[model samples]
Target: MTGETAPVAARDEADPVAVIEVQAAVLTRNFELLRRRSGFDSQLDRAGYLLLLALDSLGPSDIGTLAAALGLDPSTVGRQVAAAEGKGLVTRNPDPQDRRRSVVTASPDGLARMAELSVARQRRTTKMLAGWSVEDLAQLARMFTRYNEEVAHHYFTGIDQVGCAAPHDQPKHSTAEDDS
Candidate 1:
């Protein structure tokens, strides 16, 4: 029964809050499935994932720039980079313009692996929204994206200002937190 689908279970009687809670649980379970399939958890711990994500979005960046982008200390990001390099997921090379400075790049293999994982992640998302119409899905995406951006800008910036700097740019995006 490796590929067998599970039977659908009925939901209990629910108030609005209870319905929301059940939806949250279902979303969380779907997310966990995506993570497991992606193998991101096994490949890179939280720090490594952040580093890879930063590199993927920003391209080759100096340690200081990466640290600033992540709102983390340079030394901490340096250590994370070292770990990524050791796994052949990233490489740190001397900046051509400034030989003293270094730029980090995600390795080709790393990019390929990430792409595969991304596809698997997308499949999970599609399954989650299977019943939604295209317009509804589009609207949901827009609203969620805007909400996330606002929360990150407001809360994360405030945390940084108050000196609660973490190595990751934003805390891991949890379904519960996002829904809340």
Candidate 2:
């Protein structure tokens, strides 16, 4: 039954949310399938990857600051930092301003690993979307960004996470009058 389509229940054609839900489910599987097919693997797990991204964006920070920016529990961040440290993916130093506190940063090895992962992912995506128009990709990016923001807004309040520092920006389109 490989690549067999599931039987979908007939729902209201006008129900956009229902359609979105169905498509979202398909997208989750699509990513899994694509990743497997692409053979792109990473040593960094999702949490560690995100933690590293936050560090890259904000620079060295104490656990509390990192947790606050990422909207994660400080205890959870502490454990993640510990695990990352064990893997030599991050380094912790006593804060110069306050020796009692530790500042955590992604190690050089971690940054190199992440860079490799990112380039592999980008290559995979580019190949997957080889024929897509730039406008089409831009539209999808905008929609995805909006969807992520909405989901975050619903689940978390006052989150100031990396890659979401500001509201999504769009290029201004020129009208016919503007061409004059």
Q: Candidate 1's C-alpha lDDT? A: 0.70
User: Compared to the true structure, candidate 2 yields what TM-score?
Assistant: 0.78
What are the RMSDs of all candidates, in order? 7.5, 9.7
Q: Count the backbone clashes (under 3 Å) in each candidate.
A: 0, 0
Q: What is candidate 2's lDDT per residue for 15-113, written digit by digit as tens?
A: 887877677777888888866666554467767778888888888889988876666678999999999999998999999999999999899998887
- What does the lDDT read for residue 42 in candidate 1? 78
The models' CA-based lDDT, in order, is 0.70, 0.75
TM-scores of the candidates are: 0.61, 0.78
User: Candidate 1, residues 122-166: lDDT per residue as tens digits?
Assistant: 787799779999999989877666654545554452122212233
Question: Which residue pairs collide, candidate 1?
Answer: none
For model 2, which pairs clash? none
